[model samples]
Target chain A: MKKLFLPFLIILLLTSCRHRLVPMIGMDSNGDEVIEHVSAVNFKSSSADVMNLVAKDTLTTLSNHKFNSGWDMNHFQVGLLINTTVGPLAWKVSATPGFRLVFKKVKK
Target chain B: MKSIILIISLITSATLFASSTLPTDWYQPSFDKGANQNTLSTPSAQADEEIDHLFSTQHKTLKRLNKNANKKWKVTDYVFMLALSKSGLLGFKALNGKSVFQVYYQKKKATPVKVEESKPIDIFVHEDMTDSDLQAQIEPVLGALVATKKIDRNTTLSGDIVERINSVKQVVGNLEASTDKKFYLSAFRIDLGINSSGILLPSWAAHKGTEVVLRLQWTRIVKKGAPKALAYKSKVNSNFQAFTESVLKDLNKIDESPLASTGKKAVKVRIGMGVTTTDAIIISSAKTTFMGNLIFKRNKKYKPSKSVVTNDYQYVIDKSIDGAKKMGQISNERFIKGLNKAVKMGGYFVRKADNSKKWKVSMLRAWYILSVQGFMGLAPITATSEIELFYK
Candidate 1:
């Protein structure tokens, strides 16, 4: 009975759900388990603004061997100096659209 | 006396040119940037909150109008459909005008699924909206919410208005049926986008970003109404299964993107990396630098000066930390995560259906994307969006 208890505890710990701070995922790549840490940022703008940015030319094609063979790199971004008026407040802005971009690994 | 006049004119001309700090062709529209209003002024979180307020407020107004259970004017029966799509163009059009969406006005057939007890909403549509016009619209929404103290002035409305509309309907539906209440007002919204497919797997190539996201509630209790619209305005027309096949078959025959307006012009570029604090920054830099290499490879005009690939590039930093300091670091870190998921969204759907294992896509993965707030937003150029690839 004591031996059975030890195995149950091990299995419980391995399969338990835990709180995630960065909200990331781990996957299998080329038969090896790969845990790539993706950024945890999100765009705080509206649907109109996002599509306008992407539809406009923000997509770039990248080639790299480090990426899995099945995927290609495409960077989608809207780096604008937004004159945002939040609630009753006024507007200030940013340059470089900063780091808010959608980097996708698409297939050829 | 004539010389004096000439000197005065010269002084005026010099003053006008003095403040022109930017280069001669700075404002010229290009692929990188633009001087358009859509490029300059963007909507805020406050603007989105107003979308919710408008629906809720319109619902309330609608309820008052629908008091007569037996009356034809009562909104007990309506016909509509959610116009959400995976195509950026179709999705954009869906929100551009009410015409693109399925509409059934006074006496159409629709079933309000479920509902909760809450006040209804008011709806409004504008022909041409300017920046200030949006602010003017938000004024009343904020005013009422703050007045009732339901929310504060500084609140950020990050909630999906589309999903909320459904929840409100579900709750109101349930409440009205169970408690014999009269919460007869409901609202619906659609926000959508086509996830970015890199230069290789362009959405134009595969009919990937096309689908249905329909929901309409004509009544808490079923009723009848006349047709408000003659036909579905969806571009891809999911009603026809052959739509995707014909579109893809035609697209496959093309050598370039269907829309020549995309400005497929590519130039030579090299990417240089800068250092930063977080390990994520280093990882992100590597990804970005690789992207730079991609641009060089994709462009026809770019020529390699040396075999080692050292020259002709754009310099990328670890983060724009020096720009605004903390914000730069925080923003870049978040971008890394978003990029990761975007890749997943892009590759997952396409890969799942791989029949020969040469990277075919599957139906289940494709559905995951369509079902998932599910993704990407902006503008008094109004649109419907789903937030995805995000963190808590």
Candidate 2:
């Protein structure tokens, strides 16, 4: 039991130190470097409604980064995925100042 | 001094780690190249070639018909006769062992028939034949017939009497023998005379025969340029068909790939910030992941699953379809405008006739027959068709 405990302790430490890469949610146009954060929301929403929620969520994300001095939050792209028990509903919204919002509903 | 240096190095390393860093493979932004972005190039050159082929075939038919004739007719003269024959304008009935020529004029709103007759002459007038030329041909025969008292001085002579006097019955006999259909030659030329006020007026107008007036009006319509208009109408129709087919083919290719099914079970919003380029924020979402609190601060790399990439491509195609729909509307408007212009150009004679109001109605009918009806028949190639073809 003493010999088994030593091996288990080493395995636990190694597993805990393992570096895991987070899923990327934002990137530059060229996609060289990316910033990643997990954002989750639960509600009944449509492609149009998701646009407003995405706007608020983006502001919250930028505020968390603390390097928001030069970034233009108004002009950005948001891809929303609504997971239902039946299937996933995907939508992309591009928000540019003075330009009309273009909503694209992605088919599964 | 050694302790201070170690502390400074540690603080600098911590600051660098907190700032932006190169993305790992799992988090690399995959740029969607999108669907084809080329402008639609219609086969106009091919359509023009088709029009030329059509005209050449018609010209060949005209030449063949003239070559087989005993007396060759001018293009306009042949067209006028063909129009009259096809329109069923010339009707004949046997009366007292002699064939009497009856003229039928078809009006869409009203049909009024009247019958009357006098002398006969088979006059072959070409497109260049003027009123004076027709008068010159008729005056000598009428003067001789009136002087001899065979016909009254004031009586309007028809083609039958002139055929009898000139012994030109062979011309009429040849025309009847050339075709299976029998046509009684009853063409007339109105004599010009001075009225009470010294104004020169057609004697037929003085007679005021509705049958004669209607026949002459129809003849005028055929002679003024219906043949050229007919040729142009055929050309426009073929071109429009070719263009419509080409546009439909292009639109169908827009969403050809079948959408891949995602087996994801949860909604995940992944917000990303560009470390090196801070111009804008990127937000992406997926259905399988629920790691909302996870952040990638290390330099470790890992490849994303195939389903994630496929989902991104689906979004790209959706965006592309939206853009193509807008372009389709613009091109459709342009095509319709061009079609209208061609129609108006082809129907120039009908629109500019002396009885324009009456002919304009005919022009509208022709427009409907040539374009509107044809377009409606091809309504399946429109937006609804696009949606069905693309989605299904």
Candidate 3:
């Protein structure tokens, strides 16, 4: 029983992590999911149109990556964990013209 | 004296010249140039001007009458003639003792006057309306005409009166044939009554059977701009079917039934669904009921029976909610939250009612009020949905 307990604990931990809940995002007027935050490296210089273009590019990149795919539950859970833990650190070290996207779910 | 005579002679010569230039018989009644020249007629010119003025006035009056015809009678030519006569425009002094109709007819002989017939008034009547009911509807219009002095009260049985009645009848008939034939989407409600043949017994009593009935009712809003032929009945039916199937599918997902039995005997469970629509705002709400036998066995797993029977009834609660949300009546979050609360409350009540027979009636009678607040800080429009539960 002691020998099996470690494996059982690991399996339990893995299973619990598999079903982690993510925040729900609000929709825009066009029914598209709205990003909670958008940050550009040169905030003062970047116009609204430029920021919008950057946001769209970021969205497309995030969409193509397997981890950020919302359609798959396992991918979404994994993405939520990784993005929260490592996303901020990566944004700090990124080059110019960089932007960070953050999504926050609405409360019930 | 010589100067005075010369001035008088000059004035006489000027008068004679003016008389010679003027046409002969200029002072005559007909003002006719004699010897086969009847060109200059004063009375004829005066008659032409009077006729033009009469027609122009009639045209303006008709336009005003037509503008108000939606709520009043469409002014016919006969009515206009009567109005003109009443206003003294067609009196003896105006038309020289001849009626306006006679002058109109006389002018029509020389130049045809275009008289536009009144357009048919749009009316809708049920096919089941009786003759007396239809007559009652038409009586107020004729009465209004008589009250306004457009029609003579004493001459109610006259030919023009009959003609006016026939014209109204034609309008009613045409409208009934066209407008009432189309179908419309109507708001509706569903009621499910569950009855069981068990005495009001304690928890230790034996089990009994149950029966259920579903009732559906709808009311239509008949208006000019109402959507026609939307296949709304079938759409409602299909939507209702989807809702029921979803409920059944969710129920089937539960691995263990709440009412588990130890012995060989089977447990009884009852479920019901009800839908209702409000008339004023077209708001639709759905209620669900769950009932079970109190006889339970601990530490045993029971499968839900697959033989639960439901009637073929339609519902519109989900569709109505979606529509309301689309129209911005309620926020999406509130909508989802309300539904989730309803399901949770339903399950909780069902379990509580099943455990104790004493609390069953009271628990079922308790209503779960799901009040949805209006969106965008508008005046709070509360949509209340009642959740009911029952058990035997």
Query: In DockQ terms, which candidate is top?
Result: 1
Q: Output the lDDT of residue A10, model 2.
A: 94
- The runs of at least 3 residues in candidate 1 whose Cα sits more than 4 Å from the true structure, single-residue gaps closed, are A1-108, B1-132, B147-345, B349-392
Q: What is the DockQ of each candidate?
A: 0.01, 0.01, 0.00
Candidate 2 or 1, higher TM-score: 1
Cα-based lDDT at residue A5, candidate 2: 100
Candidate 2 residue spans exceeding 4 A from truth: A1-108, B1-43, B71-366, B369-392
Model 1, span A1-108: residue lDDT tens = 998999999887755422111111111222221112111121112222342333232221212124565543232222222222222322222323322222243535
Query: Which regions in candidate 3 have their CA more than 4 angstroms from the true location?
Result: A1-108, B1-237, B254-366, B369-383
Candidate with maximal TM-score: 3
Predicted structure 1: clash tally: 58
Q: Against the hidden reference, what TM-scores do the models get?
A: 0.17, 0.14, 0.18
- Model 1 chain B worst lDDT run, 10 consecutive residues: B1-10
Residue-level lDDT of model 2, residues B1-392, one tens digit each, is 00000000000001112222211111111132231112222223433333233223323322332221112111111110000011111101111211111111111122222211222323443323444665676577556645554335444344433322222111111111011111111222222232332232332232222112101100111222234422222232332224323332222222211121211111111111110021111111111111011111111222222441111110011112122221111233322332333222223212222121211111111111111111210111001111100000
Q: Provide the global lDDT of candidate 3 against the true structure.
A: 0.25
